[model samples]
Target: MIKRLTKHGNSLALVIDRPVLDLLEIDDQTPLSVTTDGKCLIIAPAPDEKRRQSFQSALKKVNKRYGRALKKLAE
Candidate 1:
């Protein structure tokens, strides 16, 4: 959807749709990451470092327990 930037104090702010925020499971309290690649502007929820570490730890545990079985199944 096309959106226009709204004036906010000395800055222009883009208003995100409620449904879009709901779909992404992000609330006003959620930190946002904004970046651009020369031409296009990208906006998304910032990566949670703690969550990433937790996931990595869980993956290591699972791999240690089932790595051989999983490898055999893949073959």
Candidate 2:
């Protein structure tokens, strides 16, 4: 979707759509990380360290429990 920045005081702000925010599980309270590669801008929710650790723990357990089956399926 195309978006145009709106004037906000001395700076411009991009208003994100509600549906997109809901899909990304982002809210007003969520921290956003903004970056660019010189050609364009990229905005996204900041990584949650706690969430990352939890996911890693679950992944390790799953690997331990189903590593053989998963590797077999990959073949």
Candidate 3:
């Protein structure tokens, strides 16, 4: 889908379509990570650092409880 860039005060903005936003499961306040690879621009949802830390902590606990089993499985 093509979207036109519009002027927003001193900056330009592209209005994201509702359907596209729904498909991406993003809201108006959703954080985004934008970067450029050569001439191509990439946009994606930013990782939730708090959620990530919680997940890492949970993984550590699980590993501690099942370390022997996991090590056996890896063999």
**Number of the top-ranking candidate, with TM-score as the measure:** 1
How well is each residue in 40-68 modelled by candidate 2, as lDDT tens digits?
88988999999999999999999999999
lDDT of 3 by residue, 1-75 (tens): 667899999999888888888999999799999999999778888999999999999999999999999999999
The 10-residue segment with the lowest total lDDT in model 2: 39-48
What local lDDT score does residue 63 receive in model 2, on the 0 to 100 scale?
A: 100
Q: How well does candidate 2 score on lDDT at residue 45?
A: 93
Quantify all predictions' global Cα lDDT against the true fold.
0.97, 0.96, 0.91
The positional error of residue 58 in candidate 2, measured at the CA in angstroms, is: 3.0
Candidate 1 residue 38 C-alpha distance from true site, Å:
1.8
Judge candidate 3 at residue 60 and give its lDDT.
99
For all predictions, the C-alpha RMSD in Å is 1.4, 2.2, 1.8
Give the alpha carbon lDDT tens digit for every residue of 1-75 in model 1: 999999999999999999999999999999989999999999899999999999999999999999999999999
Rank by TM-score (best first): 1, 3, 2
TM-score on alpha carbons, each prediction: 0.85, 0.71, 0.77
